[model samples]
Target: MTNLNPLVIAEIGKMANELIVTYGKYKETKEIEQTERIRIRATLLALTKKIEAETQTFQLFLEKRFEERHRLYDMAEDLMKHGMKEKDPDLINSAITLIKFTYCEDPLKGNSLLKITDTY
Candidate 1:
């Protein structure tokens, strides 16, 4: 059996730790690394779920807003037509403002899909 002096063993252990720290070297087991990887994956999954829920809610709100804007546009166009026929300057001006506020073009009908945000 080889015998190591107590002080020498302690110094060697300290030196080993120092070497590892300074060199940025680490040992990882497959199971331990997999556990950590799974934890990270679970965290990412949770965040993805939350983002998906938020996106769905935002989409609903967006659809409702789009519909409301279209309704406002229709009202503005009707007012403009009526006011033009009657020569009402104030009504015409108000109709123009409403049209400006609600005048978004229809979305492109092709395959120009909206982009999803990228995750690291």
Candidate 2:
């Protein structure tokens, strides 16, 4: 068997202690990282729920607003009929324009069938 001097034995012990300290530090960092990930995931989930609630509220508002606009369109239609009877072409054209602007299926207005369904 090879002889080991006191200095060599001491050095080996020091290196082993250093490795243990390094491993402890690594474990602590991993635990902290895991905790942070959990917190971030919980925060994201809460935000998603809040967004969904807001989206539902906006959907209801859009429905009510659309109903009101539809009523206004019916009134405009009645006005247009009266104007036609009175031989006022300008009044008829104005009502037609209003209806078009209010009810037109516009891509820019996000009025696509799929978009409306997916949004809610």
Candidate 3:
């Protein structure tokens, strides 16, 4: 799922929408044969189902990624607290490094670690 591309999802959505519009036009005008209409409906249904599945997969991937990031942030926070309590420079440095890595990877997100790291 890591290789899943957002662009591909977007394109599938666009294609599904276009198919919906096309199906509507044909239904309104009754211009095409019934078999052709049926085929279009089937294609649209398949695409809609595919989009739904892909969307779910993407959502799960994001959730897992967020959980991993939160775990890292919590670990870093714990390390920082212990380091400060024990006056350990190495632990503090390691915590700062983790915070920087997290911030650098997802700069758009509001991270408490950013505030903590800025003081050091």
lDDT, candidates in the order shown = 0.78, 0.80, 0.82
- Cα lDDT over the full model 2: 0.80
Model 2 is weakest, by summed lDDT over 10 consecutive residues, at 111-120
Off by over 4 Å in 3: 1-32, 106-120
- Evaluated with lDDT, which candidate comes out highest? 3
Residue-wise C-alpha lDDT for candidate 3, range 2-120, written one tens digit per residue: 77698998999999999999999979678567778898899889878966986786677678778888999999999999999999999999999999998789633443322433221
TM-score of each model, paired residue for residue? 0.57, 0.66, 0.60
lDDT of 1: 0.78
In angstroms, the error of model 3 at 81 is 0.3
Q: Better model by lDDT, 1 or 2?
A: 2
lDDT of 2 by residue, 1-120 (tens): 899998999999999999999999999999999999999999889879977986787687678767778787997898799889988999898888878877774423443323533332
What order do you get sorting by TM-score, best first? Answer: 2, 3, 1
Model 2 Cα displacement at 86 (Å)? Answer: 6.6
Query: For residues 1-120, could you state the per-residue lDDT of candidate 1 as single tens digits?
Result: 789999999999999999988666444465678899999999989988978987787677677767877788899999999899999999999999888766655432222224556555
In candidate 2, which residue ranges exceed 4 Å CA deviation? 83-120
Candidate 1 residues lying further than 4 Å off, grouped into runs, are: 1-28, 103-120
